[model samples]
Target: MNTMTVTKSVVMITEEASFRIKEMMEHNEEQDAFLRISVNGGGCSGLSYGMTFDQNSQENDVLDEQFGIAIIVDKEDAAILEGTKVDYKQSLMGGGFTIDNPNAIASCGCGTSFKAAARPAEEQPCE
Candidate 1:
């Protein structure tokens, strides 16, 4: 059973990030897909963020739309991701998406893994 709650500003997506994501969706031919953001256990810093294009929503998923894009976040992860901001940066070297999470107390050197203030840190060797 999938339940959706329309949230206001649960996650912030910058215009640059939206443009890049839209371009990627078009390139992958997944225009109808929803961008799902999830927090999973077992990163070097107890929590890790995952993003993928999902065609369908799962049980207890919260839905939000921004910059002409549909976004979903699992109910279980809402708290950890609340007030998070997603941005894309371009430099002479390269370009990539960066996440600014207020709940994250510490993040690994890799930048994808983080330790939330409400969660205990679990250190694991990065594979």
Candidate 2:
């Protein structure tokens, strides 16, 4: 079994993203909560990223803190999320969060949907 350790910096959040997260937490009355990151199936690209304020974390969750904010990522989801960067951008259209995941093989136009990089054994030529 591989015993590689996941570093706390596996996922990086920009300064602007950190500020926005803090603001959101203050708005939701969850300032003391952790920012939970996850991925789930069923999106247009077969996977979707999720984020939410959580009061508690699971036993196997990986915990990290940056820019004064706490974050929690599931161990299983870490592989797909590793090397991901979270940022906040402001524009005439307003502000929003952007995710840049290096492990994504493809992404849907909707933006939140993605297909993770497949393992070697799972890679096969398309018919």
Candidate 3:
């Protein structure tokens, strides 16, 4: 595996996030699957994040290992995701995953969408 340490990771995953993801994977019976993070077009803020457990990786994927969990990010999305942090937070309302991307210049109120600093031209209004 071409896994990298957290210090050199393109996207940092916090311990809390790792624990939550591991729990989900175990519950879903996908213990050996890799956590794949991707950027996709079409959101209130021009881009959105996707997370899934992938059993296979593509040729251009970047692999990282943090907290004993395998993480994969597509090469094309690396530039926009660089320095991004994934964290899990708990509150009276409940718990959820949060993403903080250094490249994001704007984000919608929904929080799942963001506009990358270099992709301002791609921004679209919410429908």
Q: Please name the candidate that would achieve the greatest lDDT relative to the true structure.
A: 1
How much is 105 displaced in model 2, in angstroms?
A: 0.4
| TM-score of candidate 1 versus the correct structure, residues matched by position | 0.90
lDDT, candidate 2, 1-127, per-residue tens: 1122334766899999999999999999999898888887756677777999998877678878889877888888888889899999999999899999999988777676778765222222232
Order of candidate numbers by TM-score, starting with the best: 1, 3, 2
The whole-model lDDT of each prediction reads 0.87, 0.80, 0.86
**Cα lDDT tens digits for candidate 1, 5-87:** 66766788999999999999999999989899888887788789888999999767889989988899988788889999999
In model 2, residue pairs whose N, Cα or C atoms come closer than 3 Å (at least 3 residues apart or on different chains), thus clashing, are none
Ranking by lDDT: 1, 3, 2
Residue 113 of model 2: what lDDT?
78
Error of 3 at 65 (Å): 0.4
Model 2: ten consecutive residues of lowest lDDT: 118-127
TM-score computed on alpha carbons, candidate 3: 0.88
- List all candidate RMSDs to the true structure: 2.1, 6.3, 2.7
The TM-scores of all predictions, comma-separated, are: 0.90, 0.85, 0.88
Model 3 lDDT, full chain set = 0.86
